[model samples]
Target: MATKTPKNPQKKHDGRRKNLIDNKNLKSPRTGIRKWVYRFFVAIIWFLILLVPVTIYYAHDLPDISEITQPKGGSTVMVMDRSGGLLASYGDVYGDWLEFDDIPAVLVQAVIATEDRRFFDHGGFDIRGFMRAMIKNITTGRMVEGGSTISQQLAKNLFLSADKTLKRKIQELLFSAWLEMNFSKEEILTYYFNRVYFGSGAYGIDAAARIFFGHNARELSLIEAAMLAGVLKGPALYSPLRDLERSYRRMGDVLDNMVEAGFIQKSVAEKTKAENVQIVDKQTGGDERYFSDWIVERAASLIGRVNEPVIIYTTLMPDIQDKANKALQRIMDQEALTHKASQAALVSLDMDGGVRAMVGGTDYTVSQYNRAAQAQRQPGSAFKLFIYLAAFERGLSPDDVMRDSPVILKGWQPKNYSGEYLGQVTLREAFVRSLNTVAVKLAERINRKNVIEMARRLGLTTPIVAE
Candidate 1:
C-alpha cells in the first residue's frame, strides 16, 4: 500500500497549485471590496487636503461681521430742496434701524413667503429649496427660480458681489453658513430687512416703505408688504416707480405665494390683490434730477468722502422744476420732428447763482447727459455780455458809440446775426442787435485777457482761451 500511494511529484505540484487557486477564488469578493475601500479612502484624504485651502481662499475676503450695521460703500446722500422736500437720493438710503420685534409681522411674513418659506427651519442652506430650484431650472431650461435662502441673500448683500461665478456662489454659501452659526434666525431676518436693497436707491424696509408708500414700514398694508417683497426679485424690473402695472402683477404673484405658504388665507390674498394699493406718486425728480445730480456732486466735493448719511439742502424749487420739465417736454414733443432735434437742456438760476430748475435733456430717462452743465459749446452772443461788462469796468458807458461794421481778425470775418450791420451804433444798440463785429472790436480794444478775468470774477469756472 505504501508503494502504491507514492504520488508523482508533478501531480503533487498541480494539486498544490489547484488549492492556491481555490483559496483565491474563495476570498475574491472581500479582496476586491477591500481594494475599492482603500482607493476610496485615499481619494477622500486627497479631497480633504485640497478642501482646506479652497475654503480658506473663499472665506478670506469675507466682510467683518462686526461691521454688520455699516454698509460696504459710503452711506446715503439725501438731497433736499431749499423748501425741505426730497428732491432725489444718491446711494443706499437706509431708514431708522428697527429691531426684529419692531418689524411688521405681515411684512416679515410676506418676505418669508415670497423669498424663502423654509427660512426659519433651514441651517442657512436650504437643500430642499436648492433642489427644487435646480429641478425647476433644469426642467424649464431657464433660471426662473433662485435657490438662495434668506441667509444666503444677506450674505451676498453684505459680503459678495452680484457676479454669477462659481467662486462667488461658493463664497456666498460659506458666508451664509457662517451667518447661521453666529446669529439667530430673527437676527438674520432683521439684517435682511435692514440691509437688502429695494428699488429707487432704498436700502431698508423703512426706506422702501417711505419711498414706495410715503409712510413708515410699520404702516405697511398687506398688499403693500407683498409688493415690497415682490420687488426683491428684480428691483429695477419690478419697481412700482418704473412700472406700476408690472409691479402690481408681481405683487399678485407674491400674494399667491403667501397664500400657498399658509401665511394668509386665499380669500384674503384675493381681496388684497383686488383692492387698489396706495403707492406714492412716482417721483423721478423729472428734469430737476439734473440739478439734484449736479448739487450732489458739488456737495460731495465740498464735504469730501461721505461715510455717514448726509442731508444736502439745495436751491431747487419743485414748482419751477415742473415748469421747466413741462416746457422742455412740450417743445421737444412738438418741434422734434420739424427741427431734427432730439434733445435740449435748460438751467434756471436765481440772481445769487442758485440753481432753481434744470432740464438736463429732452428726458432724463432717455439721456442723462446734462447739456446745461456738462456740455461745452462756443459762447456765441453770450460772450458779448462779458465784453460789454469789461468795457464798462474800463470807464466806457453802455450808450457809448461803437462801429458795428463787418470786421476781420486772423482771416475770420465777423458778421451780425442779421447779415446787416448798422454802422456807428451805440454800445447798447450794438449789444441789443448782437452785432458780432462790434463785440469782436471791443474785445480786441479792451484786451481779451481782461474779458477772461471779468468772466472769472463773475463765477465762470469754464476755461477761457482768448484766441
Candidate 2:
C-alpha cells in the first residue's frame, strides 16, 4: 500500500464479457424450436396415457377370448312339410363349421390376397393400406375398396352391428387389436372364414361351397375359391347365381390380386381364368324362393327371431310347386299378349289352411311381392258370392226373380261388367252370369251391414266401402 503495489496497469478478465454484449442481446433461433419440441413430446405422452383408460373401458365390454371359439349364433329357420320333407329354409343358411387346419390353403390364400395383402404383417390397423385405399377411393369418386383387415371384419361380424359410425369404428379397432393380441393369425382367419356371409343366403365358407359348388369347403377348386372370395365384395351384386358375367369379372380381379400378392403365379392365374369354374344349379332356383319367402313372413310370428336351427314342417309339395310354376309360365307366355296380363299368382290351399303350392309373381329375383297374399285388386265378380250368400241367409232363394235394371246409391251407379243391363233375371241366373245390378239390389235388400259381415266372415282382410 505504501508503494501503491506498483499497480501494474492491467484489464480484468470479467471486463472481456462486455466485448460480446451485442451477441448476447441477439436471440438464437434454436431457443423457440427447442421449446416447441418439448411441448410436442409432452402432448404425445398425454395422448397415450389418455388412451389407456378408454381402452380399458371398451375392453370390459368385449367378449371373453375363450368365447371366441363359439361363434355368435345365427338365425336358422327350416320350413318342412308334415311328412318331414324340406319345403324351404329362411334366416341364416349356414353349413358345418370347420377348424383352421381343416380349411384349404388355397382358399385362405385367395381370401387374404383379395381382402388384405398385408394381413400377416399388420398388428390390427394398416395405416399404409388405409392411406392407399383413401387415395384410391378419392380418385375413383367412390368406395372401390374397404381397407378393413380380416381381424376387423371378424370383430364387426361377431360382436357388432352394421352401423357406420365413428364410435363403432373405434370399437371395431379396439376389438381387432384385442383379437390380434389374444389369437394367432391362423385362428383369426379361421374365424373369419367360418363367419363371413356369401350371397344367396349362404353364410360361412362351408355353406357357400355347398350352396354354390355342391361340394364341401375342402373340395373347392382354385377358381371356385376365387369366385367365392370375389362374392365377398358385394354379395348380391357379384353373386354367381344372379349374374355370372359380373361374378366372372370379379373372380378375375381376385385372381389378379392373388397373383400380385404372390399367392399364385401370374401364369397359374391366367390358366385358371381360362378354365372358368362350374357352379351347381341348386334346386332353390327362382320359383321356389317365392314360396320360401311367403312361408318365412307368415312363420315369423310363430318362430320369432330365429337364433338356432328350427325345423318347420310345411305343406309344400315340390311336384305341385313345379306344376304350378309351369302352368303359370304357360299361361303368361300364351295368354299375356292376348289378355293384357303381365303378371299372375296362384295359391293352392287345402281345407285345413295348409298351403300346398304358391306362385307369388312372374319372377322372384326381379320382384318379390306375393300377388296371392299381398295384392289388393278388386274382386270384380268374386264379391258377389258373399253378397248372394248373405241374401240367401235372409230368406231369398236362387229361383227368386229380381230387377236387373240400373241402380244408383249415393251418386255411385253399379252396373254389369259387360256395361249392359238386363230387364229381369232370376237370382240363380244372376249368380251364374255375374249380373252386377241384381247383386247390388240384393245387397240393398238384405242390408249392407249383413253383406259386410258376411265378407268379413269369409276371411277378407282388406278395406271395404259401404257405398
Per-residue lDDT tens digits for candidate 1, residues 177-202, read 88899899999998999888885668
Error of 2 at 279 (Å): 1.3
Q: Which has the greatest lDDT?
A: 1
Estimate every model's Cα lDDT from 0 to 1.
0.83, 0.82
For TM-score, the strongest prediction is: 2
lDDT of 1 at 340: 95
Worst 10 residues of 1 by lDDT: 297-306
TM-score of each: 0.56, 0.57
Task: After the best TM-score superposition of candidate 1, give how far the Cα of residue 276 lies from its true spot, in angstroms.
Answer: 1.2
